[model samples]
Target: MSLPFSPQSSLHQRLRVGLGTMLVPLIMLAGGALISFEGAVGSFEQQDSISRQALFPLAEVEGEILELTSVATHAQPTNTMTLQNYRRKQLVIKSQLALLSDYFQGQPTKFNSVQEIRRQWLEIARLCEQIFEATEPEQLANAKVQLSQRLQGILKNTQELNYRLIAFQNEANFDKARAVREKVRYLVAFISLLALALALLFAFYLSRSITDPLQTLAKGVEKLGQGELHHRITLETQDEFNHLAETFNLMANQLEQSQQDLYRLATLDGLTEVYNRREFNRWLLVEIERSQRGEHPVSLIMVDIDHFKRLNDTYGHQAGDLALCEVAQLLQREVRPGDIVCRYGGEEFGVILPKATSADSWVIAERIRLAIAEKSVVLPSQQHIDMTASLGVATYPDHADCKERLVKQADQALYTAKYQGRNRVHSAEVNECNHQINKLQRMLVKQGT
Candidate 1:
C-alpha cells in the first residue's frame, strides 16, 4: 500500500529536534539565575557589614578621649598618669585615622563617602598633634577643648555621610535583585510552555515518521517484485528513520543493476565483445524458426585469419590478442545491426545476418576481408604488420535446417578459401579479390626474416 502522507514534511521533525537542543540550555539558564540571586543577596549583607565596621574605629577613639578628659577634671592625676593618658588618646586617634584611610582606598569613587571620611580623619589627626605639643595645664585645657570640638564635628559629618552611602547602595542592590527575580519568573513560565509544546510536536512527528517510510518501502518492494525497477523512495529528513529509507532505495537500485549485469555477462563474449557461442546458437535457432514460419532468407558467415598459427608465431601472442580486438571492431563496423557476430574460438569469428541471401552475405564477407587487408596493426616500436583473413558464407533454410549444420557448411567454405588461396572470400564458390594481400604480407615477412 502507498503511504498515507509524504515523508518530506520536515517542519514537524525540525521542531522536535530543536526542542531537544533547547532543553539543556533552559536548565542551565534557570540554574544560573538562581546563583545570581544568591550572590546579590550575599553582596547586600557584606556591604552593610563593611559600612558598620568603618564606624567602629572612630567610635573607639572618641570613647577613650572622653574618658581621659573626665579624669583630668575629677581624679587626682599623677604627671606620669596624665601624660600616659594623653599619649594613649593620641595613639588611638592616629590608629583610627589610618583605618579610615584604608577603608576609603577600595571604593569605586572616592568623592562623597571617601572624601568626607578623609577630611574628618585629618581634623582628628591635627587635634592629636596640638595635644602632643601642649606645655601647661591651661594649654592642655585649651588643647582638650580643640580636640573635643574637632572630634564632635568629625563624628557628625561621618555619621551623615555613612548613612547616605549605605542607603544608596541598598537601593541599588534592591533594584538589581528585583530585576533578576522578574527574569527568573518569566523564564520559568516560558520554559514550561516550551516543554509542553516540544513534547506534543515530538510525539506527533516521531509517530508519523515511523509509519510513513514503512508504507513507502512496502509499495516500493511490491513494484520491484513486479519488475518496475524504477521505483524509488524519497525522504527529506536527516534523522535515523530517513537514513533507513535512503538505504532501502540504494539497495533497490543495486539489485536492478545486478540483474542487468548478469544478463549481459551470460550473453556476451568476454574477449571479442560479440555474442557468446550460446547466444549465437540461440540466435541461429530463432532465425531458423522464423524462416520455417515465414519462409524468410537467412545467411551465416564463418571467418578465420589465414595462417593464424604462422602469424602468432611470427608476431608475439600479444599481437594475436590485438588481432582479435581489431577483428571484433571490424565485424561490428562492417555488419548490419540485425547481424549477430560471435567469437567461435581462438582465431575464428562467426556472423548471422537474418533475411540476407547467400549473395548479400558474400558481399558483407568480402567487405570484412578487404577491410582487414587494408589496415595494418602498428606496435609501440614503430613496427607495422599487414594481416589478411578468409571468409565463408552459407544461406540458411536453403543449404541447411539445424544451426549446427549451417555452421558446418560455412566452415567447409572457409576451408576451401584457405586451400585455394589464403586471403580471399569464398561463399558457395571462390571469388577472386582484385586487391594485393601479398605485397604487404611479403614486406612483413621480410622484416621478420
Candidate 2:
C-alpha cells in the first residue's frame, strides 16, 4: 500500500511551516521579556515618586518645626512679628502634612502613619499658639519654656518617624531590587532556552532549504557584477528566494530602461520636446571648436515671441503656452536637418546652424519668422490667435569669433528687430553706422539703386 505525495512535503511549504511554527513563540518570548522589564522599571519609579511626594515633604515639615522652636526660645517677650513668623512656619507644616495624606490616600498603612504625624504636628502648633497669646512677662517666659520642651519632645518623635520611614523605604527598595534581579535571571534563562531552540530549528531549516539557493544566488550576482545582465537565478523550491530572483531580473530590466530615459530627459526640453538649453550650449561649444579647426562658419539665430507677455495677460498662460509650442514647431519645420533648435528660455528660442554662413542663416531666420507670423494657435476655447516672432542672425568668424560674442551679437540683432518692428529678421552685421549709411544709400537708391 502506498500513500499520496503532499504539497506540504515540498521545500517551500516546509520552510513556511517551520518559520510559522517558530514565529509565534519568538514573538511571545520578546513580548514577555518587554513586559517583565517594564513592570520592574515601573515599580521602581512608583516607589521613587512616593518618596518624593511624601517623605521629602515630611523632612521639610521637621525643618520648619525646628525653626519655629528656635524663634520661641530666643525671642525676649516675643513680638507680634515673631509670633507671625511662628504661625507661618506652623501653617507650612500643616500644609505639608495635608499633602502627605493625599499622597498616601489608598494605602491604609502609610495613611495611618501620616495621621499619627499630623496629630503630633497639631499639638506642637497649639503650643506655639499658646506661646503667642501669653502677654505678661512672667506668663510669656513660662510659655516659652513650655513650648521649647514640647517642641523637643515632638522633634524626638518626628526624628523617630523619619528614621522609620527611611528604613521602610530602604527595605522596600531592597525587595524590589531582589524581585527585579530574579526576574532578569529567569528571563535570561528563558531567552537562552528559546534562542537555543530557535537556533537548532534555523540550523536545520537552513541546511535543508537555504544553503543551495543562497549559493546559486551568489553566483548569479557575481555574473551580474561582471555585466552579464541576462544571467538569472534558478531555484526549484518556489520559495521567497525564487521570488527575489525574479524581482532582481525585473530590476535589471528597469535599470536599463531608466538609463535610456535619463539620457533623453537630460538632452531634451520637457515641454517643447526639442534640444534644451544645456544640450544647446554643449552643441554650440562643439560646433565652435569645429568651425575654428575647419575654418568654416557656424550661425546662431536668436528669436523672441513678440508681445508674449501681453498675449499671456490677454488670453491666459495656457493660450501663451500654445503660441510658444506653435512657434517652436514652425522653427523646427523651417530649419535644415543639420540645424538644431532649442527652447533657450521662456518666450525665446535659439537655432544653431553648423557650417552655415551669415547670408544662409538670415534666409533661414526670415523663413522661420514668416512661418510663425502665418501660423495661428487654436486654444481650448476654440479661439484662433495669430502670433509673430522677431529673429536675429549672427554667424561665427563673420559676426564674432567666439561662441559668447556670437550669441551676444545675435541677441543685439534680435533687440534691434524688436525695436524696429515686430515680425522682422535682422542681421548682426547691420551696426548703427552701417544702418545710417545704408539709409542714405537707400534714399538715393529710391531714385533706383
Give the poorly placed runs of model 2, Cα more than 4 Å off: 1-246, 430-449
Q: Model 1, which residues run further than 4 Å from truth?
A: 1-210, 226-231, 236-241, 429-449
For 1-449, candidate 2 gives per-residue lDDT tens digits of 11111212445555665666567567767777787889889999998887777678888988998888778776543487787787688778889889878988898877887788788777766666666676777887777777777778777867876887789889999999998989877886787688778767765764656666778888888987887766776676455677877888787677667766786799988778888899989999999999867868899999999999999999999998888888888888899998999988999999999999988998999889888888999999899998899999998776775678888999999999999987899999745565566446645855685
Tens digit of per-residue lDDT, candidate 1, span 393-440: 888655565578788879998898999887888875422241134334
Please report the candidate that would top TM-score against the real structure.
1
As a TM-score, model 1 comes out at 0.49
| TM-score between candidate 2 and the true structure | 0.44
- Enumerate clash totals for all models, in the order shown: 0, 0
Candidate 2 Cα RMSD (Å)? 31.3
Q: List lDDT for all candidates, in order.
A: 0.72, 0.80
lDDT of 1 at 305: 85
